[model samples]
Target: MTLRLSSMRKGIRRLAAVDVGTNTVRMLVVSETEEGFRPVIRMRRITGMGKALRETGAIGAPEFAASLDALRDFRKELDRLGVVEYRACGTAALRESSNREEFLAEAARAGIPVGIITAREESRLTWEGISGGGGTGDGTLLMDIGGGSTELIAGPGKRDFVSLPIGVVLLSASFPLSEPPRSWELSNLGHFLAERIEAGTDLWKRRRFRRMVGTAGTFTTLAALERRMRIYRPERIDGVRMTLAKVRRWEKRLAGMTEAARLALPGMEKGRERYIVFGVCQAVAAMERFRIEDLTISDAGLLEGILRGLCGRKGRG
Candidate 1:
């Protein structure tokens, strides 16, 4: 379905969504028309804000500087395109950083207000964006694996959401797997995640969900690789079902490959190759912990979620 802006608000306006993720800064600009909203531009820069903060417990000067530069560029683009409304939100990276207020201050100085969203809000919006108001019977299990945190929410729809703190960037930095992780390392990470899963007693054990759905780059990349797509394609990845057994197999294969070998594989995005192992491990861990046999990968996530929020607000007006 084509997502379009209502004719009532159409005047060649543009809405921008900036997602300040742990590993990358992403911006999506969409034009509103009578027909709907059309994507005009999308850009992402790998900043590794989560990695830096995970190690130091604060957003270091260098990483802060780099993030500012990226945001400045994004602000310039919005001005160039004459965007009407802009919303920027930061996730796990900013949430965990001790100096997040400083970074937000710098960002505000540059004309972009960076709001730190709670994991619960992230999960709810994600489900809303993907389901588009269609209720998931027995509820749905939603997973978003960002660089700094992986959010898992199980609910009937958007209203009853729960979030977890396990993320790929956090795990990668904490584990420090050079190539193949030793059995001890894997065991430790698994135990760590298991505890998190156990804490979600009610949600994890709910018999309501018939299936699991995942959003974010990690799942999208895995789906693309599984399908052997030469280039990233949202159409191919969205709503694609991935079985737990299949993901485990792929995770095992990646665990054995060096970073160089992974980079050489077709469909592996350049910067993403380095973190594939971490992503796979997290996915596998979630599956094993929850006993989720199958997951559907979706590319529509935070950006779409933001847009939907805007639309909902507009509708209320």
Candidate 2:
């Protein structure tokens, strides 16, 4: 559905999109431009909303408080910027949590009413974000490695998507790895990731993508690390490509480092050191599973896709 706002008659419309995921809360504010949209501000916070879901079956106290605080800050930003239209979505952790309503209620009171989206809907929005409402005519395989789930989309239609239950946060939490992870632990993690991905994509076994494109935190963070950029520039990270060999290299190197050592790396995101190894393992498994040799990074994902939808430029997938 196309979203046309009468407010556009007055000229450029300011828009905002928030993604409340299992591990992080991110908000993007942009201004409509003749050339699509120009970012006004991008903010992210690692709230670890799914930190203890496996053991507790609910959002933990620390994560719940931090998430609400982040949303409150976003609310202030939106109000200050005079954002005309906005959409905030909650993903897998919220979808599966036993006490999601409590957290959702608190989030709304904090000024960000988040709608819990299904896995498939998350896949569609992710695809829309990567392609910018433009359909992928080349049969590109899109992967979004989120905190609680990983979405693999292969076609320009809604039916050809799979949201795998395994993600970095859940995977790491499910199997606690020793620092400088042991070989057996890495092996077990690899086998688990492979089996899960294979089972999830069995329905599309006959299909193949011309190329694989990875979005969300994992891929972009990997790109930033590869470049060793102390200050991340999205323009440089987006559209960058990496071969399977390079991916595997990082996987081995990172898996051998202690959390502190990893944190000391030039481009590692502060709170991501604990889980970055698992994230790379997931990427490597995906590459091997799909028989793809290289992966491309898309800095844009669900948030950007949400903005496009608000602009009335409906995405194709």
Number of the predicted model whose TM-score against the real structure is largest: 2
Stretches of candidate 1 above 4 Å error? 1-11, 33-36, 156-159, 314-317
Clashing pairs in 1: 3-37, 4-36, 4-37, 5-36, 5-37, 138-208, 150-166, 150-167
TM-score of each: 0.88, 0.94
lDDT tens readout by residue for model 1, 38-124: 777777777778776767898777778878888998999788777878789999889889999999999999888899998777777
- Which 10 successive residues of model 2 have the least lDDT summed? 1-10
lDDT (Cα, tens digit) per residue for candidate 2, span 59-100: 999999999999999999788777888899999999989999
How much is 130 displaced in model 1, in angstroms? Answer: 1.2
Task: For model 1, give the 10-residue run with minimal summed lDDT.
Answer: 1-10
Model 2 has an lDDT value of 0.86
Off by over 4 Å in 2: 1-12, 313-317
- Residue 200 in model 1: shift from native, Å? 3.3
TM value for model 1: 0.88
